[model samples]
Target: MSFVRPDIIRPPSEHASYYLPLTSGCSNNSCAFCAFSFTTLGIRDLDDVKREIDAMSLYAKSRMWMAGQPDIVYAILRQWDGKRVFLQDGDALVYPYPRLMEALQYLNAKFPALERIASYATPQDILRRSVQELRDLKKQKLGILYMGVESGDDDVLKKIRKNVSHDQMVEAAKKVKASGILLSVTVILGLGGVAGSEKHALETARILTEMDPDYAGALTLTLIPETELYREWESGRFEMITPFDSLRELKTMVEHSTFSNCFFSSMHASNYFSIRGSMPKDKGKILRQLQALLSRRDPNMLRPEFMRGL
Candidate 1:
């Protein structure tokens, strides 16, 4: 088997997180709006992955030792207060099933109190996994999945070469949820650019309502270097939506969403408004807050254009 190495790995800001780079880059690396194009895609060797996990486990322990704190080890030993792991690179789900399962099991064995293992997966990966397999994987503690359902609009999907259709995404999401895994799906605002913004927003909202993932995140479009999006901007084929317009699109999305268990978050650095709310209950409140912001169009309510790059 081929092997890949990652330059660096770090934990996410939230939770007791650690990033394990199972795959160097994304498997479906054709998204036009993605910066992942700059990175090469390859699967890492299983032995290498085991070594990485062992190293991370040691590192986590060393951190506790260096801190000279009892709380750290206590945190690890506590059942509900276990460390959360975020499998990294771009698409760690691209790892083979047996190897991925073994890695998760190994982590659990090493950590003893691992709360959950999360990873980024494309819709195609979900479609490929059987429901029973996903359930079994979940039983082994692969609890959360972060998928980029960037847009639900078929036109936008085709344009970006996301390689999945609206129907497929809906089905995949349902299966993921049914398997009892928390779904944190990301949707890109302004992917439709000026012309397709409304359609993108409405269609994406429709899908979100239908799929009703556990967590829904929205990211404003940011042009990055060496990305097809940047090239498109240079060639004048792509026109990015203003922060105001993106928020407007976001409102439309929130307004149309019917998902109850969903937690709407845009705390990502890229989005204009870091507005966060829960759904089915806080839906109306969140929508009203968003609408008020839109009506007021307060400059301070949005992230400035200069700070919007990801």
Candidate 2:
């Protein structure tokens, strides 16, 4: 199939980044809670990717528009400060290794001034490459990877169809660290629901401590309609945790996980509350905030249900 450009889903931190699509869906798309589960992965043609890079370079250099290029290209370039590039779709790192390298090489050659390039990567994708392979990409300015590790509890992982185990994710994080590329991972609070929330939170904290990622983010499970998890919720097969319960999970994770200078946050829109601080240093402060909220159990203090989003 001819690769279709995917939508502009990206990390919150990549607000200023230029979206570059190398793939259109995730390699591991069976995760029950994800919207990408409804889509199939598509690898863009390398020549097409290079053409977009060329257009971006042209626009950056002379504010010229390339014929046949989508207007979105120029639209993005208009505000782009020419620093960060974020690969798009569900998992752009799954793009064929050689082509991915070539694309980055071309990107760097065109915009040597780019500070960093980032992409969402699956554990399988990282495991498939050697440290040297990741190093090569880092040398080409692929500075960080965002990975979705929904839950670290093996039972929760299996139920969600994450496929990869806790050990595999930790291993992947290690490989990224070894390659000197920053690792950012996200885990979902309340993924195990009411019955298994405690174990889920504890195991997730264990995994986070083991991975020792440079950045860790906590996202609450916001069931998307038509998704398997949503259907399960509809049928009463899954129990959705309350806002306070979700905060409790977050607190447990924050109190338990140890990090070597990691930035941890629950700043995603899906979350009911946001607390960000350097783990270990800000651990006490973050905990006190969650504890205070838990103490009051004030619905008013939490983000309104209408405002929560995926």
Candidate 3:
């Protein structure tokens, strides 16, 4: 089958990056709350990836355009500063190891000046590769990996079909750190819903401390219409916590999770509020901010429901 190029859905931090598609969809797409759950994974051909790299190189070096190349390539190239490239789709790390390595090698050969390369990787994907393999990729400039650790509570994980256990995710983080790759993980607030909220927050804090990621982000749950979670909500099988309650979970996580110099934030658009700073140092300030907001319980102080996005 021909590879269908995916639309760019990337981390906010990668706004300046060149979107390089090695794979589309996600390897573990069964997460009930995720839009990717309805899609199948697609791996782009190594030759196709190299060709895009070639086109990127040509366009970066001179004002040139390739006739057969997709217009999106040049659209991104026009804005790209040649500093970073973010692999596209959900889990590009799930791209077959040898081919992924070759693609990175090709990218380096074409753009040695590129500073960093990044991708969203599932814990399962990291577990599949050896630390040495990840190290090799890091040497090729794969500097960061964004992982979604949704919830650490076992029940919540099973409910969401995250597949991997908290321990497995901790191991994955260890492997990524051991390989010297900067690990950035994200967890969802209110994933446990009303019934298991406290347990979810505490377990999430525990797991976050265990993983000790270089960066951690907290995102509020925003049910998409077609997702299983949304259906469950409609059927009264799932209960979402209030927005302030979501902030409470965020506060619990921030107050409890210990980090060896980590940047923690709730800056995603899905969040009702944003608080960010280096952990252990700014923990007090962040907590106070949430506390003051929680104390007032002002609806106007929070982001409106209509403004939230997946």
Candidate 4:
């Protein structure tokens, strides 16, 4: 069988020190606003994955040889240029626990000096893994987990068919955190539109504060073609929040938030103004900046539509 290698997938923030992809397709694969199917060009076999790892080893060794230096070799291997590995595709959690463990183990065996590993995981898949199993995986060097919490509004969650609930996300995040793995929860701004925007932001802020994840991300909504959300938008059944309105909602989210020690970011590509600050205390200043921007309504303060991608 032939496996198609995807050229690109959703990547973590540049601020994140390292990112890794462990699997291909998303396990849930039913979010209304998602475009994972469009992006997943192929599925890789287990053996194929091993071969990729082998190729990486050979590549690293060749680079090391070219340098003609033992001291710089470790740096070469550790550099993501040849060192950091991102398990590509949609989500890597689709791999069976044991098989996934085996692949991770093999990677470590090949590159004993690797820095960090990370992947995307749905709440359902993470919940399926026992806490002990997650902890063991952490011990094996899994560093970060990116979870798409989308929105904490239950109605919106049901509408998107996220296949998981707010409570489920909270519990799953707790488990991952308890396992000593860094948890980054994603929230989509403008998810609830102008109608539900306030409630959506408030609920999301409340949930994130409750979960108290290590990192929280906010992304403005951009409707991509072929997804259910796109259809709704095309039909005018869904009213998207304007950039200003979206920013207002983001401000609400920050204002309502109560996270004590969370690093919050809206530095995603789709966002109008990327904001990065710690929560609770910084929330006020962040909201103030956003509100001031909105009050000014300077065209230059907003990101152009062309720059925002789905």
Provide the TM-score for each candidate, comma-separated: 0.88, 0.99, 0.99, 0.88
Report the candidate with higher lDDT, 1 versus 3.
3
lDDT of 4 by residue, 1-310 (tens): 4554443455555222223334555667788898874444344567766765665676567743333323322442465453455565566766788888888898889888876677778898799998999998887778778888989999999988898888999999999988998888889999897788888989998888878988999998888789998899899888898888888888888888788688998988899988999876687788779889989988798888788765
lDDT of 1 by residue, 28-77 (tens): 88888786766677887777767656655665566323233234333433
Global lDDT scores for all candidate models: 0.80, 0.94, 0.95, 0.77
Clashes of each: 0, 0, 0, 5
* Candidate with more favorable, higher lDDT: 1 or 4: 1
Which digits, one per residue and each the tens of the lDDT, describe model 2 over residues 1-310? 7788888899999999999999998889899999999999998899999999999999898988888789888888998999999998788999999999999999999998999999999999999999999999999999999999888899999999999999999899999999999999999998999999999999999999999999999999999999999999999999999999999999999988899989999999999999999978999999999999999998999889899888
Candidate 4 Cα deviation (angstroms), residue 190 = 1.0
Query: Which numbered prediction scores highest in lDDT against the true structure?
Result: 3
Least accurate 10 contiguous residues by lDDT in model 3: 59-68
TM-score of 2: 0.99
Clashing pairs in 4: 21-86, 21-87, 22-87, 23-92, 80-84
* Model 3: residues with Cα > 4 Å off, grouped in runs: none
Cα RMSD of all models vs. native, in order, equals 4.7, 0.7, 0.7, 4.5
Tens-place lDDT digits, model 3, residues 282-301:
99999999999999999999
